[model samples]
Target: MGDLERELRDLSTWLETPEPPDVRAQVRERLHRPARRWRPLAAAALAAVLVAVLPPTRAAVADVVSGLLRFAGVSIAVSPEQTTPSGVASPLPGQRVAGLDEAQRAVRFPIRLPAKLGPPERVLVADPDPTGACRVATLLYDGGALRVDAFDGRLNLSFHKEVIPPGAEWVEVNGDFAVWVDGPHVLSYVDRAGTVHKESARLAASTLIWQDADVSYRLEGARTQAEAIEIARSLR
Candidate 1:
């Protein structure tokens, strides 16, 4: 019985009483320390989001140039043989004539004419006269041995061979096709198929055609046949 009482007393002593108030307070502070440490991390995340929402600082000109070069399938090589422009350069070759200088505008493209075809002299915009607006450029090749006429815009192309008689309107003669631009002038050309190809566009329309042989083209943009004749006379 005495041994049992001693055992019970030992157990009671082993079972500790409640902690002191100061000790309990210290434990609570330690548990909350981790929460306080996470406050700065939350602020840093918000700052990163603000920065991502801001716009860029510089314009993308390089991207534009790269796209043009890729679409053209050509590379620009600056050699010592070429000359630099002194000021704002014109789009068309300087040597060609502009019949409608007052109304025409110029634009540039990175295109090179064949050396055998000589060089382009000028490019002009054909407008106002009802033969559908056209973007036209002329090339005098081989020192007058060849003349290349390029007309750009939406065109209806056909072929025939017949030299129309003078004073006759839209007559087919000589088995040569003549392009009748809703106006008085007519363009004529013969192809390898012995077929003549004719193309015409209305005022405000554009056309592009290229030929390697000697061809007689008619400019129909002039208000009168005399004016159309004068435009043709200026070709080469």
Candidate 2:
């Protein structure tokens, strides 16, 4: 059979199967029922559409993660990006990796550290991002990296954000909807300034993210799903 036919058959099979009970609960709880049951399915279809449109060599999948909380108008999309020909994962342009004290001074919002994780061993700060909002900070622990992104400019500015290659399962964390993307995929997003960014597409870990106030916190590079959730719960 042709590849397209095989893909269609697989999609049909998935559509017929029901989502796991636990995942259903998480989606219902976090999205607050604001989204219909077909939203995720639609997202899956969108990915399929992209696959059909893009070249066969560029075929990839992404998950659209949106619901009750908009994360201050930040649209969360888990998609992949193009990579280098040499297979080298280069640092994002206009990004700097610095010490904790140095990173703290760069961003407008206060950096948060998980009680269980303590201070991060490394800190990455992004200033003058495409968004031109406030600075973005990423705290790197041994097991994973915690990202803190904020917008101090006007509210309701819509921007597209992407993370990992689309297998996100919703889970309740601290009574809030949090997403855990399985496997390592490239994470990309559009900054407030309407610029698209492609982070490293070579990440080899899972990620967990939730919102706190106006800041959207993302924890990446976890060794396991349970470890990621445990660390996320420790955020204060």
Candidate 3:
């Protein structure tokens, strides 16, 4: 729990809001409809307006919170309407292939390689800031069948979100918090500039996400929780 998140959680409790109308049907109907995405500036402004008030607007956030699951740098909210399993995977924002040296050079955080997975078949970096520092680094194994993403815990994750049914498991990685999402889940990624890159939205593989040393690691494609933890433990 970061200080800011804790503060925001506390703030949510003080808001008084009436019940918002049930728009699940409306939302579900629009699920298949193509709609324009709000610009980042406009979206952020709308969020500020909604959160600043204490009515149905605040209730809207509370509704999401009822099913929200967050840890480390990842956030997952259970979706109201089940989406079709994701199609093909696509590159994220500013994503590019790199060698280990280049990947390490692109991000400020320390990169951990899983000993069990050995040398990654591919290394990728994405979301470069103005200074050329990327926000996330990914190491792919079995040609991305199994992979891990490493990023700073304090920034750049607000753009990522996931959706899963109930029953995500909670565990500990080397005494630190960890979570296991065992089934297909809807995934969405939007960059800092508000670009929802290619088809980053998809039903991601079963994942094991853990936090350590102020950095968050999201390990996807693990077949079992124990196997995921073993691989995570091997990060060095």
Candidate 4:
């Protein structure tokens, strides 16, 4: 059978299995609800009547992610280290980044932000010397009210800001080639030469890209396009 049909059938069988009384009642209430026929008809009619009535789903998600990033004034990039997996040890206190040039290896100064932004929730430092040749740092921020930032050799921004449709999940079009169900929001950086990537799944918001000679970054979060643009502009 088709995947969707198979999934529905499996779900039906699971629902038929024995369950606690309360759980069973809740399931019944959900499955036995009256079908709304007019709604579909109405949607079709609306589509016919107004060509622009519904925004494209992928565009909608991208817009959301971009907006949030812009609001935070963050930048996206793809680092060279991301393309190759590095088995680096976790950083200990008071250690420097290994292998990088004297200047590139260290931030030298703390990152100063505008008054509008909050400090990161957590910071991860990688061992200066790892078994492999690769070395990088990870920075995490928990922007209050449901925003999370995971910045490693790459940066990922995940915000549980909206209610996703049942069975919905996030997907990326490009960058490191990974996918997950119930995955956190991600903004990643890779080497400069890689092709631009685009991804679309349920509730994606938007994806943004910034490039430089050494690193390139991608932003995937739940914000509007204007917000995403603002964040992109803030990177210096």
Q: Identify the leading candidate in terms of lDDT.
A: 3
Candidate models: Cα lDDT each = 0.28, 0.51, 0.67, 0.29
| lDDT tens per residue, model 3, 133-216 | 998999999977898988887664433455556536566678655778877777666577555443657677788877777688
The TM-scores of all predictions, comma-separated, are 0.21, 0.55, 0.67, 0.27
Model 3 CA deviation exceeding 4 Å by range = 1-65, 85-89, 193-199
lDDT score, candidate 1: 0.28
Give the TM-score (vs. native) of candidate 4: 0.27
lDDT of 4 by residue, 149-181 (tens): 222222222122222222122222222111122
Alpha carbon lDDT at 121, candidate 2: 71
| Model 2: CA > 4 A from native | 1-88, 129-134, 143-166, 199-204
Please report how far candidate 2 places residue 82 from its true position, in Å: 11
Per-prediction CA RMSD (Å): 35.3, 11.6, 12.7, 18.7
The better-scoring model by lDDT among 1 and 4 is 4
Where model 1 places Cα greater than 4 Å from the true spot, the runs are 1-96, 99-112, 121-133, 158-236
Per-residue error for 94 in candidate 1, Å, reads 19
Q: After superposition, how far is residue 46 of candidate 2 from its true place, in Å?
A: 17
Q: What's the number of clashes in each of the models?
A: 31, 2, 1, 38
**Model 3 local distance difference test score:** 0.67
What local lDDT does model 3 show for residue 53? 53
Q: In model 4, how large is the Cα lDDT of residue 66?
A: 28
